[model samples]
Target: MSRLRPVVAAAFLGLWFLSLPALAQQEQMPPPTVGVVTLQPQSVPRILTLPGRAVAESEAAIRPRVTGLVTEILYEPGTALEIGAPMFRIDPTTYEANLKSAQAQVTSAQAALTQARTSFSRTERLLGSGTTQAQVDESRAALEQAEAALQSAEAALTLAQSELDWTTVTSPIAGMASVAAVSVGDLVTAGQADPLATVTQLDPIDVDMYEPSARMLALRDDIGDGRLQLNETLQATLTLETGETYAATGELVAPGFTVSTSTGAVDTRFRFDNPRRLILPGMFLRGQIDLGTTEAFLVTQNAATRSKIGQLTAWVVRDGKATQVELTDDGTWQNHWIVTDGLEPGDTLIVDNFAALSEGATVTTVPVTLDENGVVREQPAPEAAAETAPAAE
Candidate 1:
């Protein structure tokens, strides 16, 4: 019995020793450490990001001005064209013949006019001698008729010249031309319904951006009157579909005051200089326009959550515990939420350790910083830490 008793005591003691480490761990364990950012209310620009579409500043459908068979395409397809630049050479054979005929008529009219003038001058000088008043008047009438015929012939010559010139089919505007719609030997008529090609002016491109009226309902309260300046409202930036930002800034060309009944949105147009041709017509783009600055607290996007109902809620550390609160967000500016209400100055906002946090959960905040990608680290980067550290004595 004594031998069994010693064995039991040793086994029990071993179990107790094994449990001691776990008890000590529980007793010494601290609360979950969280990364928090202190809220400092300041002036932030109210930026609105909206979807928009690109359009050419000016588009022209080029059709034939003269009727003839297309003989040669003078300009290359899909290339830049200047005003009065030849695009196509229509068959000018018939036009050339008409021009020659008109020239001959003008020459004949000139000869007839000279003869009539000579007769009229001789008759008027001899009116009191051999020539009677009626004869002189008849000569004057013939001279007037010749002059009229000459004027008519000259008018025909001018028209013939214009037609012959039009047979060259020159461009009327400077722009980029689309592919030729008609090929060689295609017979085109004057003022035809089908266009020969399309020219689009790309520089100073225009974009139509739609802003929903519902979004404007809160804008009146978000931005104050004095801050909304004419120049600031005209300024805009664009982001392409590939996630690359467009280099040039756009200017507002047209501001919308009326909302469309069907779309319930306001259409605003902005113009951008596109000398590089990076932005083409019919491209989808996203745009950001500054609605002026407002006094608000900027919260990192990582610290806030949006509900299915679109309510923005964030966790703020208060009284050493996490307090989940709803925030009034105007929008986003530079990857941060522009919070206008529901947060007080100097509030500690939990940006990291979200998974370990709950409503009223006790937490110990650690001084931390977020990287450009919003990843939280225990301390600021070395460069930032150096700048913030006190200077050496």
Candidate 2:
């Protein structure tokens, strides 16, 4: 028993001796290294993303003016058309005959007008020579009646010419043509209830963006307090259904003054140039409008944690130690938090290796930067960065 006791004691002593070195190594190890970005006040763009719908700038429904059978369809469906371009031709046979009849009447009226003037001149000459005053009066009355008939005939002729021209239905505006609702040989009436076709102007398209009224009110307050500065020009960019961004930048054409009763939002209209006809009417889209600039710290979302109660907190290196802070952010910008408060300039915002961080713990910070794509990358060394920099002009 004594021999066994001594062996156990010796074993314990050797194990303790072995663990002492490990304990000392752990104590001597340096603090965890974390990548951080130094805080600087930058003019970050304040963008508001909203749902929008594309609308045509102008649209027209084509209807026949002259009541007749549709003889020919002049315009091709889904093609561009200019103002006064022919779209449908009504049967011009009846219209042509009516026009010819009007022409004959006009000629007859002119001939009668010439004869009446000559007769009136002769009556005036013979008024004092073997011509009674009563007879001259009758001649003058006849001339007047003939002149009135000519005027009436000319007015009818004008109407006939107009009706003939109306036989060829032309476009009232320049736009893209839609399919014909009525086919050839179909009888149509003037000012009918149904349209024969449609034309839509789509090059310079309009987008109606709905913005929440509450958010707009918040923006107004922020702007009033000088928390945000408006841009010189209001612009917006669109994201298509396929998640591709549109190439054209839209301008604010109309700002809403009335709120929608059903949506709790206001409709702001934007105009965009779509020469390729990419945007059509009634297409739902996503748009990000450049509201203005606000002086705020942009913190990466990964560095921040939100509490169950919706409180945002992040770890930042302050005085060479990790410090926890409660952040007040307006919203997210580019997948990052637009922190409006609870941070100071020159603070080191720990981005990576922060899960293991604790309050008041010493931290080693490595300067890092976010690229154009919001990707975290270690900052280039001073000499290497200088070498890659563009030369002075």
Q: Which candidate tops TM-score?
A: 2
Instruction: Quote each prediction's TM-score.
Output: 0.76, 0.77
- Candidate 1 local accuracy as lDDT? 0.89
**Alpha-carbon local distance difference test for all models:** 0.89, 0.92
Clashing pairs in 1: none
TM-score, prediction 2: 0.77
The ten-residue window of minimal lDDT in model 2 covers 367-376
Q: 294, model 1: CA deviation in Å?
A: 2.3
Runs off by more than 4 Å, candidate 2? 1-31, 100-155, 306-311, 319-321, 330-335, 359-362, 379-393
lDDT for residue 104 in candidate 1, whole number 0-100:
100
For model 1, residues 79-144, the per-residue Cα lDDT tens digits are 998888888899999999999999999999999999999999999999989889999999999999
Local error of candidate 2 at residue 215 (angstroms): 1.9
Instruction: Please provide, for model 2 over 1-393, each residue's C-alpha lDDT reduced to its tens digit, 9 standing for 90 to 100.
Output: 888998999999999999999999999989999999888767778999899999999999998778999999998999999999999999988989998999899899889888988888898899878888888888889889888988988998999999999999999989999999999889999999999999999989999999999999999999999999999999999999889999999999999999999999999999999999989999999999998999999988888899999999999988899999999987778878999889998888998886779999998889998875567899889999899999999
